[model samples]
Target: MGTSLLTNSSAMTALQTLSMTNKKLDMTQNRIATGQRVSTASDNAAYWSIATTMRSDNKALGAVQDALGLGAATIDTMYTGLNGTVEVVSEIKAKLTAARTPGVDRGKIQSEITELQKQLKNTGDSAVFNGENWISVDSNSTSYNSTKSVVSSFSRAGGVVQIDTVTVDLEAIKLYDKKADATPLTNVVTGASAGTLVAVAGNITVQVGTGATVNVATTTTSTLDSIAKDIMKLGIDGLTVAVGGGQLQFANRASVNGAPAGVTIVLNGGLTAPAALATAPATETGKGILDKSYDAYNGTAWEVFSVANIDISKLTDNAADLAKLETYIAGVDDALGSITNAATNLGAIKNRIGLQQDFVKALVDSLDRGVGQLVDADMNAESTRLQALQTQQQLGIQALSIANGASQSILSLFRG
Candidate 1:
């Protein structure tokens, strides 16, 4: 090409090449600074889009990891409480076993057992994590269905996001299940009527209240239906009875308008008392008043009973009382066995949760690696490219300067 004084063709060509080289150098510098070969849609649009989508998915995977952590914490909390309860139950069993000795001081032993029971209640109540308790249910709940799930994996399939979860079944391991007491009116008060219990002929003065009383006179031939009317006249809530198995099966309601809600069913049994003026009336010993039964779901049926129906205030050192203690020991052992099985189930669930947590961690790591592969810059390659581009940039500037000097040489050719 021919050169000119105003515009040297070689200089113009060199200027354009230098400009292109500078542009390439700028892009390489940006990549180095950002550490990403595809930072925006302008840089390899397809790769940029893929990286953007993968980054969002990685964030979702992070959330899944967090959820897994929370699930693990909940399981740990429940396991702690259940383990403590097992220990407490074991202690209670030991106490009950020791109480079986003929001369063991049961009152003292019961005091210790009572303390252990309180500990169990505390542990159950406090085993909460993130406001969730798997071992113990709320007091207001009548029953519990224990099942939980944790977010484990997130993926895209068929252009749709699919979330996977890890589930844990804690039903077999629930310890402090809140159960509603079977109401006397709903459960115990049967409509079956019965014959009157006549211990000789006498007027039975039933104390309906603290000071309020009702008198029902029964003859040797008086049927029980006649006596039930007097009980209704007292206006007791859900109170009913039928004579069966040689005893009056009475459902003493918890609420009454009279006597502050405590009722004593003491039919006058002594033969010498006058029907109208019975004195020294025989009182039903520990047979009346409100009672509550606690029930636990044992996988198939409800096991309903109060723990020992314990009342150390009334325990005696008689042989009959010792036999009662033996029965209590057996019941306590049964409770221990049931709770032990429940604890074992909880442990198994805990182990399963632990494995799921590990899986979540591994999945998160894999996701990170995948995302890295999609967008991460190779430092070695980038650094090498950066060095090469920088050298090219310097050479481009030198060439442009040399081309610009070529125009100066044209001016020299015209110089004196």
Candidate 2:
């Protein structure tokens, strides 16, 4: 083309090529330095956005892993306590069995049992982690929640994020629950003929909560409702009577008055007793290791007892005391079964948390790989490109120098 001092075409072409080469070399060096192909939105917006979001999600998954770890620790604590309680309850059962011997020193056996019961309480109370105690709790507390939730996973779908949780029902596994109000003594009489008092020639005496006994002639033909009404008519303090489902329920709520008492029903001659009279107080706090009522009938009377309050000290070789001891053994066995089941459940939860921990770690690794694929620079490729660009930049500089020399040649021609 035309050679002019102000606009030399060859020099302009060489300078443009060198400038382009320098730009490419700078870009290659940046990739090598940062070790990323798409470090910013300007490089590759879609991929960068995806990688950024995935990184954020991975952080949330890390938090979920932490939560799972905390939950596992809590479960471990509960399981440890429950397992110890099972051993203590088993020992108590053995003592009750030993007490069944004809004239064994039951008072000494009871002393051992009392120590074991204390151990159970201590275990339940101390099984706490992170201020959370599942074994021993107050169900009546305002902040109490029966279901405990543990964060297990964080997921994103269609740009929406959600956290998943694993739940444990404390109600099914708790060993003790303190109540705000005292539970009363209850007697339930149930059978096909429970609601009917057959006409006979005797008197029935009912005494409730230190109140005066009420006498009602057995000859009076009465339904369960009439009997309940008659008992309520006496204005016995803290007493309630209700009849339903072929059953007569009598409750003495004297515990609310600071004195807990039992109910006694005496049947005088010729009157057939109800089919079954379960003389057990309703489940109450401080009554037992487990909230269940057990019946111990001593010929003329049925008494209520529990694993924690059973009086094996009074047991003897007599049939009545033997029967009572049998009931105590059965109640203790039930409590043991409950504790074992709770431990099993806690173990299952621990295993599930372990599995989830593994899965979350795997998921975090996968996300890292995915983000790396989108943004990370291949060092080998970047280094090779860097070498090639440096070579091109040197060649472009030489070509520009040659083009500028053409202007010198033009000056020589003018001088000639």
Candidate 3:
């Protein structure tokens, strides 16, 4: 009944059918191409939002997994370093034990001990990562780090992640019990017939002449060891002096060898006549590999003292030396045991990280599945939809044709 072309039923019906067919085709293509049921807000507003969130969660979990892997590697490096250090310590212990045995050559042991010290220093100096030394400068802090703790973070899903700093305690390597003695010895001279008196600290060295000098090593705190060397020298020569009771007794030992009178005594290092000589015995003390301190776990702390401090002038045989060495070595062994325990603790931490890595890996897998469920399209369903859309488009075109046929009938009526 409408005259205007815009109001034509056939035209309106065809346009509506075409629009519906295009919409169905679009949905089918989206599912097939994107592999997603909800690709955009227009397709499914709420489902799209949920999928977006799930995808983000998966990314976060993946990141966490990466960081955890790196963390595990870091722990491995630390453990490897500790193991090397332990081997070095064990070698030192073995050498010390051998050195303590009877009939062992102590001179050889000293040489080996010096080598061991060099190795220890090398190990400390060589601890590094990425061409950078890992050794810490912080006092009372760990060797790997001053303040940061080793940590690894993981997400419930596979996503982005971060790694925390690691710290290793290097103090276990230090041996602190041994103390060094740095006191200088005193000198005293006695029994001089005509030489002028020179003052020395509890000891005196009389210089006789050039070339020849006699060295008299002394354990006495009141006397100096070099006094004899000074008074008996090459140039003046022929001069002979005997010293006792902190007194210098001068006699002409010079024969045709020369007149002892030709020698004049000069005191060096502040030696003086009338000086009283005193002696103190040297004692043995313990010396540690490093300047560090530790609490004893099994025995009394060890100390090193000079041999002169002990009452015996010398140990009569290797047997006696071995006994003394054993006593001191026992204390060192105890200290080393504590270090082993600390390393054991680090081992435990490494194991924990291993477990955590496993957990993170499983979590990442789970997150991956969740993200797939959120965004993945069903190919089978999309195939069915494509077939259905084709059928609908065919039907829509046929219906549009039928509506045009009705308009053609109206044209026939107009012809009549």
Taken over the whole model, the C-alpha lDDT of each candidate is 0.59, 0.73, 0.48
- What tens digits encode model 3's per-residue C-alpha lDDT throughout 108-185? 765665576566556545545544333212332243332234455533325444444345544433232223522211
lDDT of 2 at 367: 95
Over the stretch 1-416, how does candidate 2's per-residue lDDT look in tens digits? 57788887877888999999898888788888898999999999999999999999999999998999999999889888888888778888999888888878998998888887778778889999999998888877899988999999999999898998989988668887775435456566653454344545566687654657778664446665566556656645444555544555655543324345556666533233332222434533332245444444553455666665667776678765675676577668777877788789888888999999999999999999999999999999889988998898899889999989888887777684
Residue 368's C-alpha lDDT in candidate 1?
70
lDDT at residue 179 of model 1 (Cα atoms): 45
In model 2, what lDDT does residue 140 have?
76
Judge candidate 3 against the unseen true structure and give its global Cα lDDT, from 0 to 1. Answer: 0.48
Candidate 3, superposed: residue stretches over 4 Å from native = 1-14, 41-46, 131-144, 155-291, 294-328
Enumerate residue pairs that collide in model 2: none
State how far residue 52 of model 3 sits from its true place (Å). 3.0
